[model samples]
Target: MRTRAKICGITRIEDIHSAVNAGADAIGFVFFPPSPRSVTQEQAKELIQHVPAYVQTVGLFVNASLDEIEQILKQAPVDILQFHGDESPEQCQQISSQVGRRWYKAIQVKPELDVINTIKSYQNVGASAVLLDTWHPELKGGTGHSFDWSKFPKLDIPLILAGGLKPDNIEDAIKTTNAYAVDVSGGVESAKGIKDQQLIEQFMQGVQRGSAK
Candidate 1:
């Protein structure tokens, strides 16, 4: 199967268009208020309106409460909900079912953690898929730091490779890990929350070329 591309941290309508034109299968909207990429519900609603029906719209949250998740769901109709925080499988499933959307769990891989058990934890939580991200003390994703691909363990669920992916290294990432899809945020931006079209295209090109190999 062809690799899927998700151009995350989209905050503008034009950027959404660029991602779609570049063949991105999904677009991410940040609901967390702490990060620079965080966008308000009103802004996301307006931006989401311009997106086509086929492309998925993902909402990123960092340990968000059920109330907050419900609020966003009411304000905007997100196609998928990405729990990017340290949420338990129960929490992930609860909010996902409450909102009635597909939930993908994010695993913060540390040095000593057992990779297989990590996958099992999310699976037990009822996540449809998992995103492998670099764990850091100060950051809540979009950190642009990559983990060791050799550290990746085998799994059957859909894997989305995140953290520090760029046009230059994306091909190798896919070839080595054979991830079903890739998620990127700061890798394609000149500044926080702002997308660079050329970089976006280059990233997509790299994904296509990598999958072909």
Candidate 2:
């Protein structure tokens, strides 16, 4: 199967068009207030409206309350919810089920954690998939750093590789992790929250080449 590409941290309509035209499988919008890429519910609604069918729109949240999420969903219709915080599996399930949307839990890859077990724990709680991102002391994600790819473990659930993936390294990342999909944010950006069309296209091409092998 082809490794899917998700061009995340989209803050512009042109970037959405570029990602779609470049064959991105998913587009992500941040709802975390602290993120530079974060968009208001109204903004996300406007942006999501432009997304064509079959191209999934994902909402990224970090430690947001259920009420906050519910309110956002009422305005912006996202196909998937991504939790990138210290939320428990139960919390993820509660929020996802309450909204009736499939969700993915992002696990910050750290040296001490048993990554496989962590994924399984979230899977048991009804997470549709698990996203692995490089861990940062002061950040949840979008740190633009890579973890030790060799440390990846085999998983039954869908695995999404994120963090520090660029055009030049995406092929290697896919090959190393055998991830079901790849999520990129800062890697495709001209600046924080600004996606570059050329970089997005190059990253997708790299995913194609890597998955083909």
Candidate 3:
């Protein structure tokens, strides 16, 4: 099967167009205020307006309240919700059910946690997929750091690999983990919150090459 790609942390209209043109299956908009790539509801609404129907739009949140999420969704046309914080399975289910959207939970891969069990836990709680990201105590994600790909466990649910993936290493990541899809932010950026069009294209090419192998 062809490996899918999600180009995340979109902050501008140009970047959105670039990602779409580069064949991104999904585009993510950060709603967490602490993230440098985060956008306002109005900003996300405007950016999402330019996105076509086929490309999925994801909203990234960090332990946001239902009210906050609802308020944002009221304006922005987000297709999926990605929880990237310390939300419990029940909390995730509650929010997703209330919003009536499929959701993904980001699992920060740490040596102490049983990765397989964590994935199963999220799946049991109704997560559509589990996004694997590098662990950092201070930063939830977008750390530009990579975890040990060798440690990934076999999973029934789709694995969306994230953290430190660039055009150079995306092929290696896919081949190693056999991930269903890949999510990239800092990897395709000229700077934090600034995406490079060429990098986006190269990343997609890498995904194609990796899937082919």
Candidate 4:
């Protein structure tokens, strides 16, 4: 019931302030060029300059090369990295070791997904936590498609629920998934990449209201 929240796909400076003001524990910037919310490393760095301490700056990526990841580390001071691609355990471990810190990996869960198997698949990958995100099958996250909540049984690892989570459904998603955290991207946006402050607040409130139960 007690779960943290992360709002991803931040493209504008005002949205960053809005998320922090709304009490989001973390804010994610999309580094994947294909995503509408994508930002350049320089832009990401500038956006993070005024981000207060205690609020994590998470960088989300697809299948990026290690060199590219290194470039990001050199350019931006991110607290966390979120790998949303088909990266192997060895690769994830390598990236964490390279960065001198642990990071999160997203597991694409299809309909009728089994939580146990999904957790095991990533446990050996040295992921700090496993995120249950919708798999578009053709795309890597940011699709706005969600998996069935009934599909997730019980999970043991630190779980962050994602995909199609918005003000209308976030509360129900958290209550049903029993996740340790909830991640929202396209859900609270006015468009593909633009974030709406009112929606962000309402979504966060919905999650809080649901957890109170």
TM-score of each candidate structure, all chains considered together: 0.97, 0.99, 0.98, 0.94
lDDT for residue 123 in candidate 1, whole number 0-100: 83
Kindly list the per-residue Cα lDDT of model 4 for residues 1-213, writing each as its tens digit: 468999998888899888999989998989999877899999998899868999988988787878899888898868888988878767877887887767888988865666577577667777778888887868888778788887755656788888888899988887887788999988889998789999999998987976876
Looking at model 3, the pairs that clash are none
For candidate 4, the lDDT comes to 0.84
Off by over 4 Å in 1: none
Q: Write the per-residue lDDT of candidate 3 for residues 1-213, one digit (tens) a residue.
A: 989999999999999999999899999999998889999999999999999989999999999999999999999959999999999889999999999999999999887998888888889989999999999989999999999999876778998999999999999999998999999999999999999999999999999999995
- Per-residue lDDT of candidate 2, residues 89-133 (tens digit): 999999999999999999999889888889998999899899999
TM-score, cand. 3 vs. native: 0.98
Candidate 4 deviant stretches above 4 angstroms: 111-115
Candidate 1, residues 25-142: lDDT per residue as tens digits?
Answer: 9999999889899999999999999899899999999999989988887888889999998898888888888878998988877888787887888787788889999988878788
The CA lDDT of each predicted structure is 0.89, 0.94, 0.94, 0.84
Candidate 2 has a TM-score of 0.99
Model 4 TM-score? 0.94
Q: Name the runs in model 2 displaced over 4 angstroms.
A: none
Of the pair 1 and 2, which is ahead by lDDT? 2
